[model samples]
Target: MSVAELRPNMDFWQERVDMAAAFRWTERLNMHEGVANHFSLAVNDDGTQFLMNPNQMHFRRIKASDLLFLDANNPKTLEGPDAPDPTAWGLHGSIHRRCPHARCVMHVHSTHATVLAALADSTLPPIDQNTATFYNRYVVDNQFGGLAFEEEGERCASMMSDPKVKTMIMGNHGVLVIGSSVADTFNRLYYFERAAETYIRALQTGQPLRVLSDEIAEKTAQELEDYPEQDVRHLNELKAILDEEGSNYAS
Candidate 1:
């Protein structure tokens, strides 16, 4: 559809469709682990109000209309019939509530990323171009207090407040990536897994890793940041594929 075709009133619907598409695409890419992980996008500027997947819903079957709206400060979310997963509410909700820059949050336990997270040293070494994409721009939260219950979730969200850091390797847990938009966040999540895979493979080689210098790594990261608009195209193409595949994600 052309830009002119998107009515101003349909902004919320469009964002929902885009977010649902991200969920389906993540499933297709094998990044989803059953119904375990969560993805959320803020609907309001303050980030306190957001959309998240309902509890126990598989990512592959998530519909645009199935997402639940939540307020970070609403403690009643945990007691309702339509309540979200506690951990999801805790982690995604708290981040959305506290970090205005984190408009989109994608948390996953994809194999490679989780593997890296499991390591004592969970930092992604700048050993390749993909790794360099996150060099000096990622943070590590080495505290793992099990599930992100209310307080634990707040702690995790606090670790993600730095706008300069888009990716957070949740030590002994999984990975959390945030962005100002769903497409950007999903794109980062996609590439992060690939980078983690490559890093793990290189480590398996048992050879001394040829790490990049700080100057080069910083330059490459800046270059990657400059090309942020490509994520929209990437997401659009994925949506096009879903359109052809008779997806019910937007239903």
Candidate 2:
């Protein structure tokens, strides 16, 4: 059968496709960390139920049908045949269960973001438009209490309690971002990495930095947030490119 013919007509099919495309594109951007990181999307009204990538799967190879549907409240989730990675279950489950507003969660150990996270100040200054986009919008988790098991996950989720904070600079760890959808979250993740790269490269130059004023930074952030359909268009164009290349992500 053709890939389209075998596609499942289940709930959240489009969400799965979008998420798979995000995964593929993330890999293409060299943002994925081997088979370690994860992405999840809430599938239920309360966000307790969600979909996640299968355990240890590489982003480039993940198809829409390969996602695992999970319930954060279910204790037996980790014991199933298609069980997710423990850290994924712990981190994503905590977010989905505690933060209903965070409909989608993406975690990565991308190079620049992780470097920023490792810094003593883990702060992204408003150096330029890209960096300014995240001004005062991210929370820095200074406490790195090992891997994201249940307790660690709970602590991380606690920091995201503020409705306005959509990104977390996981201190000594990686980065985590949440949004209303896959496109929005992935877009944030992509830009955050780009912003981090810019900041890091600037720091390496040893030259005096030209930082934006707080007022202008906030204004830029707000303007970028309100930009029309950029996130949707970004993901659509990526999916179109994948389709043209005969990628199986949507399958």
Candidate 3:
């Protein structure tokens, strides 16, 4: 589904809850980097307004109501009392503004993905079905400017604006997964790191890799793309765990 499709009688509050759960689960999975890294979901029908975590808040402790609402086009948002991390606003704001297809975005520096990013050939080799999911579906931001201020964010946004790009492997940095929904984006984020881990582990072995042929890899990727709505179910299961464990994320 598309961002426009996500609008109309939508429950923005429910979106907050879902996004907060994503944060908590990311923390549980040890994917968070202190108070850094950010995720955002567009709240507006046009995808210009979004919800982001406030600066310096640990993901595990974030609650649904703790999310900050800001407009992508509003320059004065940074001056507000609940201003988001500059890098968060820069990266997420630009993407939500320029790439409507990217209604939900997950940016992280998970261990394996970051390890892969640091390598000279950072492209994810299609050695298995998991790695094939991103066969031709990702972009590589080879230039790693210091922090992602608005300028760097704009550059990143432009890279993702291309309709074909669903994942971005930032050289010397990490990964960014974009999708139409938080569930889909989160699932992709989880699997992309899994794929990276597989690649890194294979590299650690002294033997050469038996990489998949381009024909087989592309076929597997398309099949993965055609797979049904498991992401929504995945998010539902996650929320159920939070409900049973505690409801801190729901607020």
State which candidate has the highest TM-score. 2
Superior by TM-score: candidate 2 or candidate 3: 2
**Model 2, position 176: C-alpha lDDT score:** 98
lDDT of each: 0.90, 0.94, 0.90
Ranking by TM-score: 2, 1, 3
Expressed as tens digits, the lDDT of each residue in 1-251 for candidate 3 is: 54335444335778888999999999999999999989999988878998888899999999878888889999898998888999999899999999998999899999999998899889998999899999999988899997999999998999987777899999999999999899989999999999999999998997899999999999999898888987899999999999899777977
Q: Per-residue lDDT tens digits of candidate 1, residues 1-251?
A: 65335444444777888999999999998999899899999988798888899999999999887888888878788899999998898888888878999999999999999999999889998999899999988999888999988799889888877799999999988899999899899989999999999999999999999999999999998999898588999999999999999988876
By the TM-score metric, which is better: model 1 or model 2? 2
lDDT order of candidates, top first: 2, 3, 1
lDDT agreement of model 3 with the native: 0.90
Q: Using lDDT as the measure, which candidate wins?
A: 2
Candidate 1 to truth, TM: 0.95
lDDT of 2 by residue, 1-251 (tens): 55446664666788899999999999999999999999999999999999999999999899998999999999999998999999999999999999999999999999999999999999999999999999999999999999899889999999998878999999999899999999999999999999999999999999999999999999999999999999999999999999999998987
Candidate 1 at 98: error in angstroms? 1.3
Alpha-carbon runs more than 4 Å astray in model 3: 1-11
Q: Please give the range of 10 consecutive residues that has the lowest summed lDDT in model 3.
A: 1-10
